[model samples]
Target: MESDSETHSGEDTTPDDWMDLAVDSPDGSPAASPAATQKPSEEEDFKLSLITWNVDGLDLEKRPERSRGLVKYLNLHNPDVVFLQELVPPYVQFLKEQLVNYLMIEGGRNGCFTGMLLKKSRVKLVESEMVAFPTTKMRRNLLVAQVIVNGQKLCLMTSHFESCKENTAERLKQLHVVKRRLKHAPDDVTIVFGGDTNLRDAEVTKVGLPATVCDVWERLGKQEHCRYTWDTSANNNKTFPFVARCRFDRIYLRPAIKRGIPRLAPDHMALVGLEKLDCGRYTSDHWGIYCTFSAE
Candidate 1:
C-alpha cells in the first residue's frame, strides 16, 4: 500500500487530467524483426508506435509467467513508448531487469500504480511528474512525461483512473484534470495519453474531449475487432461468473497545432495479449492496446 506522504491532494479543475511475463509467444508467431533505422527522406514521414496495458500486477499469482508474457509482447511490438497501469514493485523490477532498452518512469515508489517506458534508443527524456486525483479512493494519479522522439516534441501521459462502475463521478473528475492538462500543453508538443481508463462510452461523452484531441481507436475508424478490450467472455482470466465486455482501456492523441511542427496522426491500431500464456492464463484481464502514428 502507498503511504500518505506519497499521495498529493487533488486540485479543482475543469476538463483535464490524466508489465511482463513469461512463457511462450501468445500468438505462436515469431517475434517481429526490428525495423532498421533509416534517415527519412524529405518524402518519408517519422513514425511512432505505442502500447498501453494493465498487467494485473496486484494478482500476485503466476506473476512471473505473466510478466514473461508481457516481455514477449514488448519484443513483438517493439513500441517506442509504453503506458502501464496497476504496476507493483516486483513487477516493475522484473521489467527493469529484462527491458534494458527502455527508460522507465514510475508513478509511485511502492504499492500498485502506473508507469511509462520510453525506448532508450528512440526517445530522449525531458521531464516527468505525477498529478494526484484529489478525491480518489483508489489512490489514482496521472503520470505525465515529456520526451523528444525523432526530433518531435511529444508529451506522454497515463493513468489507471478510478475503477468500478460505482466510482463514475470520481473517474470523471480525474478525466477533467487530464483534459485540462492536455488543453494547456504547449502547442508544439503532440500528446498521447493511454492506460486502463476504466471508462464507459457514456462517461466519456459526458465529459467530452478537447477540440484538438481524438480517441485513437475512433480516429482509426473504431474497428469492431479491437473495440472490446475487457471482454470477460473471451479472456476468462478473472474467472467472473457472469459475462461482460467493455472497452475500459483506451488511447487518445492530441496532435501539435503549431505551424511547422509535424502533426502526428493515427495510422494503425490493434489489440494485444489475446492468447493465453503457457501457464494457461491470459496476460491480463484487459487486453493491451497497440497503436501507430505517422508524423506528416
Candidate 2:
C-alpha cells in the first residue's frame, strides 16, 4: 500500500483533494478488458456478491491466531468482495498471506482501520483510496475502491464513523464529508456503501445521501430475517452489554442505470461467522451482511 495522502481541515477540500488513486488490476491483469469496457448487453452478467464486517478491532496483538479462523469463516461464504472495519494492519498482513484468493486494500487511523478484500479473478481493482475526516481530535475514514466487476464498473466503499452516542454531531460531520468527497468519483459506475456507520437509520438519512441511494435492507422491504443487524443479548461478539439492538450495520446502493436497477437477491444476511467456538467465544461481535446483486 502506498503511504496514504491526507489533509486536515474543518471544511471541504477541493474535489481533487479526495485522494483518487490508480492501482494495477489484481495480479497484473489489465485494468479493464475490451469486453469489460463495451456497452452492456442485456445478456451481460453483472452479478456481484459482497460481505461487510466489523471484527471489533481484531489485530495481531489482540488475537494472534484469529486470522486463521477468520479466513476459514470468510472463505466459506464465497464472497466476491469483503469490506472490513477495525481490522488492524498486522492482521491484514497475515490475512493477505492466508487468504490467497483475495487481495487486501486498507485505510483508516486511530485504530479504526477499514479494509476491503476482492476475490482476484472476479474483480479488477482499478483504484483504491482512503478519504479522511479529522474531527474530535480523531481521524475517521471512508475506504473506497473502483473496480471492474464482471464487466461492470463499480465503486464500492465501507466506513467506520464516529462511535459514541454523544458524538452524533461528529458522526454527522464525518458522514457529510464522505458524501461530498465521493461527488468527484467516476460518474457512470454503480456505487455501493456498507459497513458500521455507528449511527441508526434515521440518523444516517439525516446526513442526506443522494436520493438515488437506498438502504438495501429497507429497500428489500426490511425482511423479517434481517430485521435486526445488531443485538446485544443474542449475538456472539458482544459489545455495549446493555445497548438494545438497532440496525446499526447496513448496506446501501445506487444502481448503475436509471431503469436497469439491479435486483438484490434473497437471503442477504450470512450470520454463520457469529457461531460460537468450543470455548464459547463468537467469531465477531457483529454478524456480517451478505448480498448478491444482479444488474438488470
Candidate 3:
C-alpha cells in the first residue's frame, strides 16, 4: 500500500484536528425525519438501495467543491445505506452537515479510515464496532454495523483493505477476516459488505466467499458497463501517463439462511460519479457502485 505521505501529500491538517468531532452516538440513534413517519405496508415487497465509494479524501485540490459534488450525487441517489472508504475528518464533517437524514458511523478517528451511513428513515442502527487487522501497515480495519430495515436484520460491513499490488498477502489476510465474520454471523441476519477492497480476482478465488455469499457484480451477470470501478482511463481526477482499469471497489451479499426472513436478491447495479463536476474533476479517482436489492 502507498504510504500516507506518498498518496496524500496535499493533506494539511493533522489527525488530532478532528478527533473530538469523530465521536459516534451511544446508540447510533438518528434524528427523526418526515420520511421516518411513513411506513411501507407489510404486503409490499421491500427494496434496499446501497452505494459504496472511495471518496479520495486525501487529495486536497478542489476539496470543497468536490465534496459538494459528492453530496449532490448522494442526494440524487438517496441510497438506503452507504459504505464509504478513504474518509478523512474534514470530509466526514462536510457529509454530516449536508446529509442530515443519515446516521454516520466512523471506523476510526485518526487518519484516513472507513465509514458507514445509514438512512434515518429506512434503517435503524442496533450497534457498531470496528475490527482491527493485526498486521496492517496502513492502519486499515473493518467497520461493521448491525442495522434493522423493515424489521429484518442486516449486518453491514465496510473496509479499505491494504492497497497496492505488492501487498497482496496483507490484503488476503484482511479478506479472511471479513469472510470469517460473514460465516459466523447469525443465520437470520443478512450480510452486505462493500468497499474499496483493493483485491484482484485471483485473490478472491483463492480465499473464496462462503457458499451463501455472492459477489453482487458477478451475481448480476458482470455487466461490462459497471465492471471497472477504478478505471484511470475513464476517471481523470488523478493524472497519469498510462491508462489503467481495475475492479477495486466491490459489494458482496449473503442473504439470511434461516426461514421466515425474506431473501434479498440483487436486482439492479450501476456506476455513479461518471460525470465530471464543474471544476473539471470527477467525484473521486474511483467510480462509485450503486445497487438495489429486492426482498423476495
Candidate 4:
C-alpha cells in the first residue's frame, strides 16, 4: 500500500489535486496501474462483506417488487451494512416493512439520499450525521452509522456525490468534501464508504483521499477489463456518457481490504435499455457491486 505522503510526492500540489491513478478491473487483474510482481498472502484473515447498489427510482408501490428482491438478497449474504442510493422516503417506509428487524437511516436531498438498512439483531446504530458542503448547490449528504457487528464497531458511510457538470475545480472541491469527511472520521472506528459517486474515467483524477482509504475496484489493477456500471448505447463516447461502458456508481472502503465478492442483484430485475436512461420499465440504470470480507 502506498502512503498518502508517498502518493503526494509528485507535482499537483493544489489542495484538491489528485494524481491519475490506474486502477484494476473486476477480474482481479491490473489495468491502468502497473501489475504487481507478487500477490498478497491468501491466508490473511479479518473479512467483511459490503454491497453497493442504486435501486433506480425506488417507487413506493411499483418498485416494492424490487425492494422485495433486495431484501431477500440481503437475507442471503447478510452484510454488516448495505449502502444504497436513490431511495426515497416512501420506499424507505416500504423497505422498513419488508426488512422487519432492521434499523434504517437516510440522508442527502430529495432525489439522492443515501441509506443504510442494518439488521436490528446483528447491529446497533450508535451515531450518524449529514456531510454539509458550503460550495455545493444541493448539499450532498452522507449518512454515517457507527454499528456493532458481531462484537465489532464498524463505521459505514452512505454517500451520493454531486453530478451536474461544472468546472474541474468545482468538482474537485466537492470531492474534497467527501475526502475530508472520511479523513476526519474517528481513526479508531473501522470505516467503510460506499455509494453512487457519479464519476467517469476522466473525473477520477479529481478525487483526493488518504491512502488508508482506497477505491476497492482500483486495487484489482486491470483497468481495461469489461467493467462498466452504466450502459451507454446511445452516446458516441461523448461527455455525458464517456465510454461504451461507464461505471458511475462506486464503493470506497476504509480498513477493509479488497477481496472480490460476487455481484448480486435483484433476481427478477433487468436493464431493458441504457443503464442511465430509465425508460419506465427497468429497475435502475446502475448494477450492484458486492464484495465480501471475513468478520473474524
**What is the model-wide C-alpha lDDT for candidate 2?**
0.65
Task: Please provide, for model 2 over 79-195, each residue's C-alpha lDDT reduced to its tens digit, 9 standing for 90 to 100.
Answer: 778888877645565555556567777675335577888877677888887765666444567777888876667888888877877888988887786666445445567888888
Error of 3 at 10 (Å): 19
2 against 4, candidate with superior TM-score:
2
Clash count, one per candidate: 21, 1, 0, 16
Candidate 3, 204: how far from true, in Å?
0.4
Q: Which candidate comes out best when scored by lDDT?
A: 3
**Order of candidates by lDDT, top first?**
3, 1, 2, 4
Model 3, residue 129: distance off in Å is 0.1
lDDT, model 1: 0.82
Return whichever of 2 and 4 wins on lDDT: 2
Question: Candidate 2's error at 228, in angstroms?
Answer: 2.6
Deviation in angstroms for 207 in model 3? 0.7
lDDT of 3 by residue, 1-296 (tens): 22221112223343343333332335654223334345645543288999999999999877676777777778778788999998887788767755778888888776898888898878999888788788999999888888899889999999999999999999999999999988989999999999999999999999999999999999999899989999988788899988989999999999999998889989999999999988899889989999999987
Taking all chains together, the TM-score of candidate 4 against the true structure is 0.65
User: Model 4 off-target regions past 4 Å?
Assistant: 1-46, 58-62, 108-112, 167-170, 223-226, 233-244, 256-281
lDDT of candidate 1 over 75-104, digit per residue (tens): 778888899999887777667656766778
